[model samples]
Target: MNPSSDDTMHTLLIRPKAGRLLFSLLCSLLFTLPAHAQEADTARVKELQGVEVVGRHVTGKLRHDSLGGMSLDLSFLDDMPRIAGNADPIRYTQLLPSVQTSSELDAGLYVQGCDNAHNGVSINGVQLYDIQHILGIFSVFNPSHYSRLQFAGSAFTASAANRLGGFIDMQRPDTLAGRVKGELSVGLISSQGTLRLPLGGKSELILSGRGAYINLLYGRWLKVEESAIRYSFCDANVTWLYRPDARNTLWLDFYGGNDRMDYQEDGENYDARLGWGNRMVSMNWEWKRRGLTLRQTAYMTRYGNRFSIERPDFRLRMPSGITDYGYRLSLRRGRWTAGTDWTLHSIRPQQPETEGERQTTTLSATRRHSTEGSLWADCRFAVARNMELLGGLRANVYTIRRSAFFSADPVLSLLWTSGYGQFRLTANVKHQYLFRTGLSAVNLPTDFWLPADERLRPQYAYGLSAEYRTDLIPGRLQLSAGLYYKRLCHQTEYIGTPFELIYGDYDYRKNLISGKGENYGLDLMIEKRTGRLTGWMSYSLGRALRRYPGRFSGTFPAGHERIHEFNAVATWKAGRRWSFGATLVWAGGTPFTPPSYFYLQNGNLLSQFGDYNSGRLSTYIRLDVSATCRIKVHGGRESGLNFSVYNANCRHNDLFWRLKFNNGQYYYAPLRPLPKKLPFLPSINYYIKF
Candidate 1:
């Protein structure tokens, strides 16, 4: 039989090995179909033939409109090497293709070249503003508290349209356990515990807590000759699930975390204290009847921080934060899902309070209030026998003071399944009403949140992507590849330094310049899904460029852009009692603007900056490995000991640069690297499960 045009096109697009697999699958399908337009006669059949395969497992879940997304089970984190003896969800996303962070220790996610504020992060369907603890070392989401994590790439559903970049969702287990279960872990730097208790036959409660003791165990370890620092953090999470009946369910979630840091510099006559915290609470209810389901939710969250600096002659304190109250309602029936969501925001930009030898003064930005709402609908349907279409529409409204803005966003995805594998093409348009601005070079808690207004308008993005996936070796190996492009509008870059931001006029809008950006990339990965050895290797090639009419005449590279990235991760189950994991990550350096010239005039100095993001840091490379051994307990329970080395090679990678004057000329040099003395970080943890 001759193949159709669609089949021919698909074959051409796929690789040679995948083409052959598709041919085989097509042949099997054709032969298994009924010869005539009639059902087979079951009574006359003599015997049935079948094939059974063992020792094979499905590794990842397939989600609709997930052309370049990932749906990972909680067990996936267990198989990977930990960072600082902790399994962090935000850090895991950095290992995937087409995703990047500010640096090794930064937790902010920059997806498809978008800023951290553009990405939406949520737990139990409620959006969260500050999602990290201990600065950027660890995220607030404890792996033990979450059952699954989902990352949506360029293509996202209508309900998640507000984010211009991507979406990160953490979900707890929906099922109620019949018996009591718990896990406890103690590590070199921190300790955590999770416990699940059944209230009755239909209700259950899960409690999790984590805290850091680095300050207690190794005080001033991250210190230099003239400076010393101390930092600590703690967080708690509680989730309650109630399944009163087969068709009804209710959930209550609460999370709170805080971070504190103290620093002193004797040579510079500087001393500072920084503190931040996050608190959130949410309630959800769900009901199902026949083939329809309805859900409602309400949530409230707040994040705030204070930074105080003291010198011999001056004292200054800056405070900033944001608070949100939100509500959502959704209904689903068969292939259709619709939802409405609204949120009210209260924002306080960074403002400084100063006390001099003479008097005390306070400088503050205008406190602002805003509201955002969205109506969305998503549907999936079959277009042909082997093709499906998933589409969604979102209408958003934003109100700030007396002004209002509206936008319509859309998402579309096409999926094709055959004997060989699957192919998906997706596109989406998104908008973000909130923006994040940071004073530090990297992602830090000092960053402040602001809402869109007349001067700083909302951000918009348009994205398109195509992906292909197929099994290369039955149940053992798989291949995935994708191409994506995104166009961004109304991107803002703050041109002020930390001092200017803190001491200058409170009208912060004067320091921001709006611009446009474009990002395109290619992602490829190959993995072995089963057997004694299971792992994956991935590579990404991408470019991110920005243009501002007044600030710069030419296009320049974005600060977060990384042109090349490669990662290799593997896990070996040496035996039932022992397991080993290793990972390697290498990427291009970050971009920075160097000083062009400096002049001294009348006992003062002035400098001119060079091209935007023209200088590059040294290449970044790191290797991590871990080993774990399991032991049996008295009552059939299990315990494990894990030893991990974050940067085994101790390669000191440059975090940023500093300008220096040499021979009367100015030049830029690599500043102090992170973990100044020892880049090699090792830790051990003991865990038990019952």
Candidate 2:
């Protein structure tokens, strides 16, 4: 029996050759038939019903594409309340379900109980060590330059390795623009602009610049009551894209930024100048054809910090930095991908110089050389009708001086999909050869990078997690929950004074104590996606602990650990031109170590230390609100004005506590917050796009 009309049409849709043949036959019949016959045939042919196709895409604040990865849509930043009139990526990242930050005044992603140094950050596939400015108030990445952020917590791609915690990848699109465009923004503390020019049909270029005149705006207020202080920062970016054809593309990216602070003691006789910066340039090329893809990247990056002090008796200069040259190559076809990465690191731990009346002396003038290489491969395949598996392996080699170390890490993820929701189970092992150490409790530019050698072993982490997500309201509301446990090995804690660690000429390795750590947590989140009022609420319950077998004793709370954290973010679109946003964050305070007692020793007062990380600070609470108005101009242009208030409740959330010895007694108290003159800040920003 012949198929019905609908069945025949379905077959034709499935078989392109049959559809093409039928189309050709119809054309020939129209051309050969007589006019009356053609008219009669056309009148008899029936019109087909319209067909519609729909596809799924990710939207909203958080996305779960991979087993243990979450991607954030950059557009959300535009509608959220910003700090100091600046939309910050790092600050928003800390609001993710399982993510944690050191403190309000700090800018570091402490994911899964791992420290900031354990996380990896890359821009256009190039590694960046220092990605912060203004004492962590802002990230180096401008909101206008990028559109998305990918974070891999447990299961990451093969191309991103060498990190024990999470990996953040921010890639700029390499495509030709259809027209010229530009964006300009002016805020209370800084100003930034970006311009994109189409250099013909196949090439495009982007330029961006940002400058912060904090001293110009708050110089008098920033100064201590008895001291003189000034600060400034600036950065520039350039990106070039060439797409000769559909199969080949190339990109060149360059970024450079510098931060400087000058301080003079009011009554003392010493003046100091501190500066730090980052410079990087990278080139990437890709080729794709017929289900196969190839990519290659080469880059160079440098981060340096310098501190100088001048006094009546002598002058001192201390400098430390790290420079890297790296290359990466990757290829993919179907469900398999493989890559190789290699980098050469040149580290200057510290080279201090002191000048007297007649001569200049230099200390620790040695540069450590290290090399790291890795080969990795990954594949994804279906194991059952509703189950799939993703697995990968990485082989790493590290060499510093004459010593070498090797490790093999594995990643596995299993996924099961059902009508109700999706569930994922993931396991991963990662390692880090570079270590970041500093004396400050916060993330400061003075922190330096160190290589793993014979004395200091590489750090490694093993983690296991299970997560489930579902659409509670089918396209409007969603819910996700995850539970994870991570174990860390060969962790190191610094046990030396700042002067000794940064200037004194001692075996620095001896000051480091090796230990182990464990982190376990539960993360839950619910989000509203499609509505005029959209937002997400998240809660995290976690514990991070460390055990130093020799130095202190048993396990203790990690400095950045928070036992309970809750966050809610919402944005309301009142109309086409007006919108409002608000964010609320509340969390338990982290742990600290305080002095137990004080006594007179050798004619000097000394204090016996208490248990490590035994003291907990008070709870932290913050609320922010913002309102924005946008106006449409000619030629589809847009102009906007935004007003933001940080710490709207005027709460006194302390950054940290310091030990104070007064009246022959020892105690600990909260230190003065940043922007000492102002407990809260309200800012305005004006922006335009054409």
Candidate 3:
């Protein structure tokens, strides 16, 4: 986007808000060095070896943990064990507080009892609608190209509107100055590739791609026929920097992704394909002119998804997508920051649900649409040397065929530095106007299988949190702890589904569901990073509940509610030749269906779930270990091998709860209640870098 036009209009439009202008200028000045400063940062004493410092995050004092647990990267791989080679990012995040995740293959992440759909996830500001990968063993993005990742569990600014759980902000590394670097790897699930280019020294482009062959690798009985099952995806990101001089730099970033899956079953050949690629182009120009400092960021993110299925007898095409365009104009001077934020988002979920009784061939499609606009102002101030205060509010209005939704999300923050540690407190509330179903989710298993309700009301959540950060050994070791309380209302959930909507609801232009929810939880983490022995330990405890449609009553226990979860990761490094790491995670199971004789309810056999997760499943345990060895190649090129084993002990943890007779037997046979474990698969990855 060419931001100059908007910048000029913004300056003129805000000419009357003189007080805000002064405040912004004051805040920018506080982040700048004094006129007489001769040193940049004293910490740049040594050239980091194979270790890269992350970005200069804005809220450094707000978090106390040593980095690894928050956002993983390449350096931490030094001693980690490799299980074949997939480390699911969604599972990795569940180690935090109030987080409850399903089995290993479950792409769904329930935070503090919130449903899977409640969580908001994005890459470089581009929201990811489809999160499942290879039956849920991994994330959609290729891990090889990940940069810096930040996750906030509860309420955030208006930018995070629809979610009940938290916000995940992933930032890619800035384009390297004069290096052309890239990496390629081959693994069990897919073939992966990445390339980082200098782009003639002015800008850089980093692109990555992955293709999976699980359908071909493990075909069902249909494999005997003209069988088919294959999936693949790719992502590209480009960062352009304009550094005409020191103290002034402009940045433009763009990113996109595409994925698809094809399969055929029974004696029939059918194809199911999901595709969505977004373009997020942004430009941020920062400069300090005279005594005033200005930083303006203007960008737009557009996302869309299309699902199409085909067979010899039928054709189904459903497309639903969203386009979001927004910009943040912030000015900081002295100890104050003031800005305005505006955005426009439009969505169209196209689905078709026309069908006749399926004797053999079946096809269906559907859609829904919503558009919204918002405006807001943010303000911050340094009240004292180590204390600060911040506040903001956003007002948004939606346009739809039914009644429109209006909201005003508010944000408040405070920071204090004491002799013991730094305390950060934040109070946030948001009202989200989201469809019970989103079109962007079409590619995943969860997407359009449900129906849509245009009469639904907006959802709301209020969250308050207090966090503390302190250095145990100054810059070496760190510790952090925090408490959170949240209240949610008006969320949606799915109920009974007819067979016609299941296999037939191929076009996700509409969603079918009916239910509401409410929940809250607490979070905590600690870590150590300095020498070769660098890793961290984390623990989370919280709960969330729901009330979905039921024949017996109103709403009941949600499917995602879990009680406790914990994780411990540590590594030891011996010289440059060897390093070993181990990770352990334990969590209580969630509410699920139990087995019992059915009783007539509403003239239909309705078996009770038995105390909503009253039955405990087997505890989960896994040990992952990996070894790293490097050798020099020609032209000073270096290559290494990473071998990892996941679920090293191969414990059969419960994947899903099943039913059995009260006498410990099956409905009519001798089979007793049994717990199913997700299969453990190990992978080896070979990588060559240039």
Top candidate on TM-score is 1
Clashes of each: 0, 0, 47
Order candidates by TM-score, high to low.
1, 2, 3
Local distance difference test values of all predictions, in order? 0.79, 0.80, 0.56
TM-score of each candidate structure, all chains considered together: 0.89, 0.89, 0.73
Worst 10 residues of 3 by lDDT: 2-11
Tens digit of per-residue lDDT, candidate 1, span 398-438: 99999999999999989887776778888889888998886
Best by lDDT: 2
Q: Residue 620 of candidate 2: its Cα lDDT? A: 85
Model 1's alpha-carbon lDDT is 0.79
Expressed as tens digits, the lDDT of each residue in 646-690 for candidate 2 is 888788777777754444555567864545556677889998988
Clashing pairs in 2: none
Write one digit per residue (lDDT tens) for candidate 3, span 461-512.
7777787666565544667777777767666543333323435534222333
